[model samples]
Target: MVSIEMIVAARARLRGHARRTPLLSSPFLDEIAGRRLFIKAECLQHTGSFKFRGGWSAVSALEPEVRARGVIAFSSGNHAQGVALAARLHGVPSVIIMPDDAPKLKISNTRALGAEVVLYDRAKEDRDAIGARLSEERRLTLIKPFDEPQVIAGQGTTGLEIAEQAEEEGVSSAEVLAPCGGGGLTSGIALALEARTPGFRVRPCEPEGFDDTTRSLASGRIERNATLSGSICDAIITPQPGNITFPILKRLAGPGIVVTDEEALRAMALAFTRLKIVVEPGGAVALAAALFHGEQLQEDAAIVVTSGGNVDDEMFARALALRG
Candidate 1:
């Protein structure tokens, strides 16, 4: 289990490495949500996603000799780039296994960041098998996206920032919503808030078809999505809640919220026009839930973590078209 102590240590490791992203608000967005909405603009995070924190935590925590050997990760896009960049900064070799259909920008960016990129089919290929084989062959460390304790601790640092920022903003209580994939960020934030601000609860938000976390939380068990590749919000789509993250999420999180792809895209449009922040569809789901699913919430204010802004140009243009 991830504790506040571990999170503090991770923060220590990240002192100069991670950016303490801001908590932003707009009266216009507040009006739409019928509550004060604070946006934790992690879209502005390094590699344009919060994954960098986890990547850095995992890479930096490794034994120096082991780390020098290299690291490997499997991601759709954001995690790929996050791990790629973190490894580069640490002067370690990284091999990233990404789905072939991930955003072109993300694939290109990971390669550009100085990692070996390997592509695989999402539906047929087992990324775990491939990663295991690669790790064995190359003597590389595997940074499991959401399941590693150090990675969770790193992501929990985001919660620590939210707690401080909310205090600074005079927000004693608010629901913190984060886009959920395998539940790393949501569970991490939940654990952090559990210690820092009991009044602040974390909720996992997901795209409609890929609402496995939402369903799993309601049922008190892990739930699997029927398919993984159809959503426009690809970043948060996962086969199921992670084994390690589910227990934390089930223990600490509030009822999950589900949003549609259209809502995500509209939220993206709103972020661009109103907040002047570029948000990818997956990153916008939490804001989508905060704005469009208010009846499901009880808080007077909501803090939304826009997790990433790594959308492809064509998809971003589609979101921009929804601005009206």
Candidate 2:
């Protein structure tokens, strides 16, 4: 479990690096939900996602010798860019292993950031096996996408900032929501909120077809390892919650709420049209939950962390059409 001290340390370590992303009020969502809504726009973060918080935190926490050895990670998109950018900041080399079906924009962005990219087949080949072999052969330190304590601690800083921003804005006990893929961001937010405010409720927003966190919370075990289907939310396409993130989420999160692909696409379009922000399908899941799952939220003041904004042009048009 991550402690408040760890979050504080992470904040200090990432002080100059990570953006103090804004918490913008959404009157549109507020009118729809009949409650105030604040968005912590991590999509505006460096590398265009909140993943940089954990990525930089993990890399910065490493010992000098480990940094000297460099790092390796497996990710489909946002985390890949995070690791690549973080490694570059620390003057360390990084190797990223991504699924062959990973987004082309993400692959190109990772390469642009000076990281070596290796593609593997997620269906036919095991990415973990390939990563392990590479780690052993190259003597590189493995930096997992979401399963490490330092990574969780780093992610917790976002929650810490949110709580502080809420307090500054004179709102107490707001409902905090985040997109859950491998559970890193959700678990970290819950831990930080529980420690800092103790009155706030942190919830996970998941894609309907890929609601592993929701199903796992309902079943009392992390068992949904099936591949996601029929969704444009590729950034959050995970088979299951991360082993390290599941237990923490179970202990700290309120509940997992699932939103459909249509809802997510609508939310993405709404964000882009109204807020003038470009949010990807996965990043808009929290907003979808707010719009579609309002009954579960009741009259609570809500805050959704818009996680990323990387989307292809064709997909963006499709999402906009879904809104219509």
Q: Give a tens-digit lDDT track for model 2, residues 1-324.
A: 578788889999999999999988667778876778888999999999999999999999999888878899999889999989999999999999988887799999999999999998877899889999999998999988888888999889999999999999898877898998998888888888988888888889988778888889888799674665456888887889888889888887858889988888888888886688888999999988887788888436898999999888888899888746
Give per-residue CA lDDT, model 1, range 1-324, as digits (tens): 778899999999999999999999999999999999999999999999999999999999999999999999999989888899999999999999999999999999999999999999987999999999999999999999999999999999999999999999999999999999999899889989999999898999999989999999999999899988789998888899999999999888969999999999999999988899999999999999999999999989999999999998899899888764
TM-score of each: 0.99, 0.97
In model 2, the Cα lDDT at residue 110 comes to 95
Which residue runs of candidate 2 sit more than 4 Å off their true CA positions?
none
- Evaluated with lDDT, which candidate comes out highest? 1
What's the residue-level lDDT of 9 in candidate 2? 95
Worst 10 residues of 2 by lDDT: 223-232
lDDT of 2 at 168: 91
